[model samples]
Target: MTTEMGNPRSRDIVLIILSNSIQRLTFLPVYHHATVVVMCCLWLQTKQSLFPIALVTNASVHVIMYGYYLLCVMGLLPKWKRLVTDCQIVQFVISFVVSVLMLYYNFTGFGCSGILGRCFNAVFNASLLTLFVNFHSEDYAKKKQG
Candidate 1:
């Protein structure tokens, strides 16, 4: 199949369009709501001083990525998909590092909550990183080769 724009309407292209459309219509809004929860939880943690300072620092990275996500969803950035794929690679690296540091800090016999928090952190970051890696390879690597 081929689109009117002369682009091949392959399965990958269809999936990409569907994913972006879903992100624009729903995912981004839900993500913003989740950010509110994160911010509130961070603020509460700040008051308690339970978590290490890295948690606070990591929030800034999330905010930066959220802004980039918003821009991509809004179609304000040209070549936005490529730009976002590149940014996701950076985000994944930073997230993985932060998550590991968080786990390290609490390795000395932390409570169940502490352990679970790090577990969730690792899983979430890893999952997103995998998705982005697959997307990047499918979208760009094949294009370059073919």
Candidate 2:
């Protein structure tokens, strides 16, 4: 049943443990690091098959974001700054959908793990979505108007 549902329990545990340790060593603001650590711990407790999907989506978006910043640093500012924001917004929307699905599956089936963590994740994503939308409106919308 676990294998059929895509929840490779042991592997997910190891991955979350490794990621948590690495995050501890990395230089992030204290609050951000703490938040990530908590999230990682929560994920460690989750048996949800969709956890990896969320992780991959978030990581992919960050890779693109950092790549965009790298281009700007190299004096090659891509004209696709708006695209980066668009991607972030899209990622959040996808995350919300995934969270909803997780909830549905949790109630309808054998239940998912790490639901608490998923709630925290949804709130965090919501805040980021709000901030990014405001940034887009203030930066891009103004340009279009004036």
Candidate 3:
């Protein structure tokens, strides 16, 4: 009887770990965008202005990507996963676009430079937190198995 219970408990642990992994991967895109936004904000602090063209491009891409994530969380966007879906792909796209746009905006000096510490961040935190939390615990397992 003890052996039977032990195996079952181990199975539960494995399922929980797998679920958490899925949760982390699913949110990778948002996390990547957030980190980039944080980096951009840090860069802007010393510059005090986002007028340079390169700055404009990078800032714009980040804003767009952030917007995508924000909308997705609010169910404004489609569920991220599809037949070919992987959240990391979205993240990679955001990173690449941000880099390319950074250079472009830097050249043109046209961009929305400040989106951090504003509605985006607050909504980002709230939505992502809630999104992941819902994927956790007994509720998630039930959903997963069903």
Candidate 4:
């Protein structure tokens, strides 16, 4: 809670980016990337097996990027947690922990690479979800309502 003096959380920056999405220019990249990926998948289905798989794999990358932004733009994720906790720091800690574990896994290769990598991405990327849950479960939201 002790926000030294002038700095803010990365979630604030992310929220700013989300807010800007209301403008037409800012919204187009998300839409364009999403649509292109989808179209690539559909096109890949025609005659090539590898193309389909590759398309799906690449498209999933965009799915998270654009989808997360879209959710932020829609006000689906709450915004108050940054007032109490440093989201950027928390996310960085989480990422660091996961990265250490992933390095261990890299040496061990103890399980499926695909699944492990995907789990890493999804877990680290749940900052917005965590923010939403924190906002809803905290007293601030209620206080603001009154």
Candidate 5:
């Protein structure tokens, strides 16, 4: 899934732009805007080393999710829509693990940066995870029953 973009920074920038643009165009929920703002704040802080993990994971998920949308747009609806939701859930779980590790390191070690941002991120991630899980259950449960 690698692109010809030789520079990682360029790829990150493009992904961020595309993600934000898509979010705006789709008029995503308020929580999505909050997540974007929190991420921007985390990125602006120079000391937040863990921000890249969140960025890369989220960007990767967006790539997959949007790719699915593209397929659907071309009248090629894939049967693996559930996989996108699964990937999103996995992304949040990974974020939770990374956030916990960040907290542990902040307390036990020299201290990590963006501790406050991490707290906000944890709350947002939890809420998003709950929403995604509910969507998965309701969507697929009805599919199964009907």
Candidate 6:
């Protein structure tokens, strides 16, 4: 349902905000972080110390990503909202590429369990990126038109 101004309703806005926050704090991070830990475990089991270092670095990327997403949701820097919205495209690209790469590595180098973790990461990233793109287009794209 549309507001009188043809914008979304307050309820919709609140729901969107809550949904975004929930995805950031829970769904996205859980899979990404879990994959990192699982990969670290796999690396340890295989006596591959260098792999865990890469896994930690990969985790740091998600840290920056979710941290910024939370900042946007919190409106801690309202001035940056437009910037964040625009940057969402770039963020999605980065996340998608990373997930795909990790998935490829896990599939090639490890067994069933490692591949499963990477698959979770891939699915999470896909969902998160889809949300970002749809939100950006619905929110910002229409603003530009009118």
Maximum-lDDT candidate:
5
Model 4 lDDT tens row, 27-127 = 32343333334333343343322333433544454445445557766888754434323443344355445545555665686632444443434353354
- The TM-scores, one per candidate, come to 0.47, 0.67, 0.24, 0.25, 0.74, 0.43
Choose 3 or 5, whichever is better by TM-score. 5
Best by TM-score: 5
Model 6 residue runs over 4 Å out of place are 1-78, 110-113
RMSD of each: 11.6, 9.5, 16.3, 14.4, 6.7, 11.7
Residue 15 in model 3: lDDT:
48
Estimate the TM-score for candidate 2: 0.67
Sorted by TM-score (best first), the order is 5, 2, 1, 6, 4, 3
For residues 40-132, could you state the per-residue lDDT of candidate 1 as single tens digits? Answer: 354344442334443444455555655675786687874445665676577667767866766776676553244554555566667667766
- What global local distance difference test value does model 3 have? 0.44
Candidate 6 accuracy as TM-score: 0.43
In candidate 5, which residue ranges exceed 4 Å CA deviation? 1-28
Off by over 4 Å in 4: 1-81, 115-146
Candidate 5, 14-78: lDDT as tens digits: 56577676444322344465456655565556456687777789789878978897898799989
Residue runs of model 1 more than 4 Å from their true location after superposition: 1-80, 109-115
Q: Is candidate 4 or candidate 6 better by lDDT?
A: 6
Off by over 4 Å in 3: 1-51, 78-146
Model 3 C-alpha lDDT per residue in residues 18-72, reported as the tens digit of each score: 6575454334344534444554455456442332543454445455545565686
Count of residue pairs whose backbone atoms collide, per candidate: 0, 0, 13, 0, 0, 0
Mind sharing the TM-score for model 1?
0.47
